[model samples]
Target chain A: MRAGDEEISVSSTSGSRPTSKDAVINLDHGDPTMYESFWKRMGHRGDITIAGWQGISYFSDVTNLCWFLEPEFDHEIRRLHRLVGNAVADGHFVVVGTGSTQLFQAALYALSPPDTPHPLSVVSAAPYYSSYPAVTDYLRSGLYRWAGDASAFKGNIYIELVCSPNNPDGSIREAVLKSENGTIIHDLAYYWPQYTPITHAEDHDIMLFTVSKTTGHAGSRLGWALVKDKEVAKRMIKFVELNSIGVSKDSQFRAAKILKAISDGYELPNPKNKYKLFDFGHLLMSVRWKRLREAVKVSGIFSLPEFQSSYCTFTGKRTETYPAFAWLKCEKEGVEDCENFLRSHKILSRNGKHFGAARKFVRISMLERDETFELFIERLSSLT
Target chain B: MRAGDEEISVSSTSGSRPTSKDAVINLDHGDPTMYESFWKRMGHRGDITIAGWQGISYFSDVTNLCWFLEPEFDHEIRRLHRLVGNAVADGHFVVVGTGSTQLFQAALYALSPPDTPHPLSVVSAAPYYSSYPAVTDYLRSGLYRWAGDASAFKGNIYIELVCSPNNPDGSIREAVLKSENGTIIHDLAYYWPQYTPITHAEDHDIMLFTVSKTTGHAGSRLGWALVKDKEVAKRMIKFVELNSIGVSKDSQFRAAKILKAISDGYELPNPKNKYKLFDFGHLLMSVRWKRLREAVKVSGIFSLPEFQSSYCTFTGKRTETYPAFAWLKCEKEGVEDCENFLRSHKILSRNGKHFGAARKFVRISMLERDETFELFIERLSSLT
Candidate 1:
């Protein structure tokens, strides 16, 4: 058990106050629940149906679900094949995964040598996905050094994880030369319809997607990576089967179900909308961008840049696509910690420093509903 | 990209046969969707709101639902703490997973030393989880050695994954003392109210629980391990966060919602079910046990000595409590390869060999709803 709670005190300048007494206007973390009133407006509530005794036999049920899913989604497979075929038009094979994060770890596992010493050179562009440095440090026992800038990224580096439409800064597709010296794994977590049209399908050796973002059900835990090389995909899939106990067969079915829902909508259209099927099957591109623009205007503490200036669009034109995240260069004065300032006030924004950026950039999620947006704006305004 | 498609032709066994033409009874796999009629009854048609967007975004209105998830449940830190606490009580702390399989690989990562010239040795009791060997082999690059018996388990051994209520044979808890040489991680996926009392609060150092079993909502992609050691839990949690880009925040909320549902039913009293709650709960348990017994009696392909010799005890019965899984020791005369035989017959039972067991055992799930159980019995009878 816990060896007698040794009172360990942690002090953070942004949030070191006694949490119990301190009323936190939390902007530091990305919990969607911060927008409670809005969730109630949508169909979500607090009522959960217990599988009851039915839950007792879920193990067997799960095994069976996997069996049913493999065949029923043959159309899905074909659809994925068609999607991959589009990727193959660029040349890639879609590697299905529990989440693209699994693929990220797998890529590291597959590429990194076991004997690699501490300070293995790992590099990424400034303001990339925050998790890149976090994951690398985590895997290497907090010993993995974050190699300098992408421009200066050289030497016998072990691996590099880069995210487009980057986590905190919302940087989209940038250029990269072949990293023959180090293995390069592109984490295109937001490369779906939200950030951009699914272009450059065959550009990278690895690309990842999940049901969470594409379907707006991040809880589904279904994500996959498209690997140009079959060997990598095979390794990644095998890695997944070993992790999280094969991504809950039930999860895959749900993903397939959700995907089926998307496809079904496409095949059987809603006449009221004047379309034969739901043109936007399971994706959330246009709506999110609108919300992002709205949030930026309301929350004055954030510094907004022109399109693509924040790694969003390649050009400044308002397009039909962009991811759900708006990376804001938070004005932290000389503190140089944008993520910290927001967290102190109870807003959970991601710190850009984790993504190799020197400045304090924070990633604000546009996933909240209207009331939440208002609350976030109010809270943000007060903070500034 | 996939190499020249023209050059890759499959043998007949591996070739894509027409679904209708290629059926040996598929008992080897565990899928409950085979009985879709029940799911429709359960109101699992599809999410009406999710039908709108075709992409997932941070600001997607998906979380704003009135279906019964509370806003408080979305706190990731608190929820993740609970998830970690649950895992620790089960005896292992390594969250090295996006899935349990990911943990399996993480165990290897933790256990396997880089300088060892020979492949690391992995050992488990017979009739283990099937994915063990498959995942282990996949990670070893065809070099890891599987020391078959518990007695021979020895040095240079990186890790050992053990499962209680041994998958195919239903051996409740292995005598772990005999196999304590290596870092022992237990896959207690089935250790729930079925085999273990909900009151069996005696926590272990590590264990695993997936929503698939606890709530029958496998699609949630939520699972956790209970690791007691703080250090290990920290590492595993880090591994998980890095691998899957942090578990689907949405899935975590849904799972917590379901968990509260399960806990609520047992903890509170409702007017609709005075004694009805207790009675209904027990009845559900009986239903599962009855189904397992009936399937065995009618099919006669497998023997379930545990069920035949089980008692209705509340606690400390030294018996497995997970009612959903029926680990069977296969005794059929010609069926040496349990996996192949079950697959050929269209009954998808997991082969026991992967679980470090003799090939005579297979893990069969008891999660089929009542009607499907009846149908499965008929299919089994036909096999006889």
Candidate 2:
């Protein structure tokens, strides 16, 4: 609830302390490049070779509703979900997408009634993912329109996008508006054990997961949506079909291999199984959070939200959340625009106004390279 | 143009095909699996491997507007276009997409004026590509709406989609709606040497090309648009960024390799280079069309459009167009619906009405595997 005022001594990492004063530090977007070192340590276990003739066909499995989805990709997705115990993939239809972003749009399209006299209202709580409003309105879709602030919304029939371990601000969330006619889409991109506790196996009407956040393969551009309803799943597939014919099988093939490697690190009966993706991610996130907290304490100008500890079934431990981003609030006198203040110091951060929050709040990515994070900490510590 | 009723004698191929009678021939979609054999012959030339830590970041080149586009892929694209003398890629911004389908939607978004009081009307000449209206209106976008048949459209301020070597019907076409205020997106997906004669280098304001049609990698789900206008290209890139963040780097990496292999077949100074993709495609298409014509002549029930020969700049030879899809019209009495007529005999074809054409005509994909095409020809030969 407040900035950590007490300084705690800790052993320094092998990486050199940041001293660069001229390098531009951009913590605007959650790029997730921090996981690159772990992956490099994992090495060729995740490497995949795709021949010219293999996966050349348009259809992967013609019998499935999502015919474009690679069978191996689907298998690995379900396997990963089962391994983590974060989401229930059993008896649910899996629809693969270009990314969670595309699947989000498809969810909105599927949930909205086509025969409605007006565009279906789409709402999320205040400080929602920055993209929710921008993406919803960018296309100017008549099928659905963004109705900001779900708790303030009065409509009964609306689509709610609940980003649990939410973006900009990391908080486990559910639909604030209570209505039977309302549809909810759970964006569980950050619900993995690394960022938050696997409190329960989520069995929502619709859930979206992305490799970008889970395995830090942002360039792979692969995501999947698990839908409980057959019709809604089919409609989402239809949207993808009409959008890109289907996803790239090359990504699917590579992603399947990458995910298989991750799952194998835990599931396989091996002596040295230390390359577990979640374990690596969790350790990195914890360290980053600790470093950020120390930097904030030294700066004496910013405050961070305190998260409650929860028991994680996957990790078999009670731990506080380690979000991919830091929602920092500028507490300095007359520092109303925290993002602008940071920009003046050669630090780029996303203004909280984009997420429908106060000008004093700014979202700083904690998923950048180690050197960049060190630079950010050094810059922050120098601010006061 | 009318169907050629004359008996065309063709030398029989070595393969003992046309024996499968119970097989269900689904030519409803252009799967483009026929190019598999060509790639197989090329073998290992198009293979690509990605390391666990490579391409982990979301950005490929932050300096470019299309930041997600791999510089290697862009270079290969320009190299291929120059080698083939198809589209003018120089001095143009290259925007990679999920497929040409995604780029088409992006074009629609870019071309449509967002502030217009009414949705910008989108029209293509009939019978246009079947998905034009479906994709344009599926989202019910307020930015643009599908206005059927470009030739019949009354509005001067509209967007025109001109598919050269047009889908369903293989006619080299230009925009029918010629207005100073009108925007045209030329879908040159089938304008390659194998599908059609490339008479001149295309220099359209917006041109879309896909590997699915050009290189027979439909599963790759990769395409690029060459845009003359900088602002228009930027808007299209924005649409893609919002739709999927960007195209998959896996696909881009593999597609670049595949395209490079194709170009290398001709460019590499080797005497025994026999794995030319276009040559293979052209030969197969010629044989398929010959067999199809012969089968139709024997069936005496279906008609096909007659095409004129043109000098190809790339091939340096005069040849009639070999379209990826056959526009087959039922000549039999009482057969008002050709798609339905074909469906009864276990042969699948897309209904012509979907393309704003007569129900008597259907579009049969010419890009399916050899076995399927052989079965289709046999089925057609036995239909009457």
Q: Of the candidates shown, which would achieve the greatest lDDT relative to the real structure?
A: 2
Best-fitting candidate, measured by TM-score?
2
Pairs with backbone N, CA or C atoms under 3 Å apart (clashes), candidate 2:
none
Which RMSD values do the candidates have, in order?
Answer: 9.5, 6.5
Instruction: Tell me the tens digit of each residue's lDDT in model 2 across B1-384.
Output: 011101110112111123457756778778788887887887788888888888878888766778889999999999999989999999899999999999999999999886777999999999999888878888878889988898888979999999999997999998887789999999999999998888999999999999999899988899999999999998898789889989999999999999999999999875875778888888899999999999999999998998999999998899778999999999999999998899799887788888889989999889888888988888899988
TM-score of 1: 0.61
Per-residue CA lDDT of candidate 2, range A91-210, in tens?
899999999999998899889887777999999998888888878888778889988899889979899889998997998898898889998999999999889889999999899999
Listed for each candidate, the true contacts retained, as a fraction, are: 0.22, 0.78
Candidate 1: RMSD over Cα atoms? 9.5
| Model 1 lDDT tens row, B1-384 | 112111111122221112442343333333333222323333422121222221222222222221112233333323433432323232333232343455555445444443456766666766555555545543333224455555555553445656654565555564443435456667766554444443334255556555554445554445555566665554454345445534543454445544554344444675554322223334555666666667667767777655433433332243334445566665678878765666666656555654555667666655554544455455655555
Deviation from truth (RMSD, Å), model 2: 6.5
Badly placed stretches (over 4 Å) of model 2 are A1-20, B1-20
